[model samples]
Target: MKEFMTNNDYHDIGFNGPNYTWCNNKEGLARIWERLDRIWLNSKSIMDLSNAVVKHLPRISSDHCPILLQIENKKMHNNREIRFKNMWCSYEVAKGIIAKS
Candidate 1:
């Protein structure tokens, strides 16, 4: 796994909340906990999503905890269309610019 990650320039982003993501539903010494899940990203992804965070959610009905990846300070809605006014054709400069295009 380490070799694969190194070759692909991927890194463990780490996590918040619980330290362990997996656990045995046993009592006392019979119980065990381990970090079996992880979140990884490549160098470009790390830079592109600098605000990204990993969080370990509660273990509900399953032995493994759910992980959440959150990205802050991002614009979620960017589907606005660029509209050009037909009135621009009335101006000499706009006509010159439009002709150049």
Candidate 2:
């Protein structure tokens, strides 16, 4: 996590979720529970985005649910459509071939 964050230059870091989301369905002596997932950020992100937070939501299925992220930033324009594209899969020589294909 640290390496990824540092390489990407992310800032704030935190974990938000149920303390124990996983549990074994068994009697007293045989039961086991654990918190398996979490969210993370870095120091620069926290300092730059003061209102960022990760909130734990209600459990729905299995033993765990999802978390809600609240990031306070400038609002987007009403007509804007957000499009995400992954740029890390390109091979230099094959870039044109991949793009055309």
RMSD for each of the candidates: 6.5, 16.9
Worst 10 residues of 1 by lDDT: 74-83
Q: Could you tell me how far off, in angstroms, the CA of residue 22 lies in candidate 2 after the best superposition?
A: 2.9
Question: For model 1, which pairs clash?
Answer: none
State, as a TM-score between 0 and 1, how close model 1 is to the true structure.
0.69
Stretches of model 2 off by over 4 angstroms after superposition = 1-17, 25-27, 73-101
Per-model TM against the reference: 0.69, 0.46
lDDT values for all models: 0.92, 0.65
At residue 35, what lDDT does model 1 achieve? 96
- RMSD of model 1 against the true structure: 6.5
lDDT tens per residue, model 2, 1-101:
66886788765455466666566656798987766555556666667777777766766766665666788787666896745345634557656656675
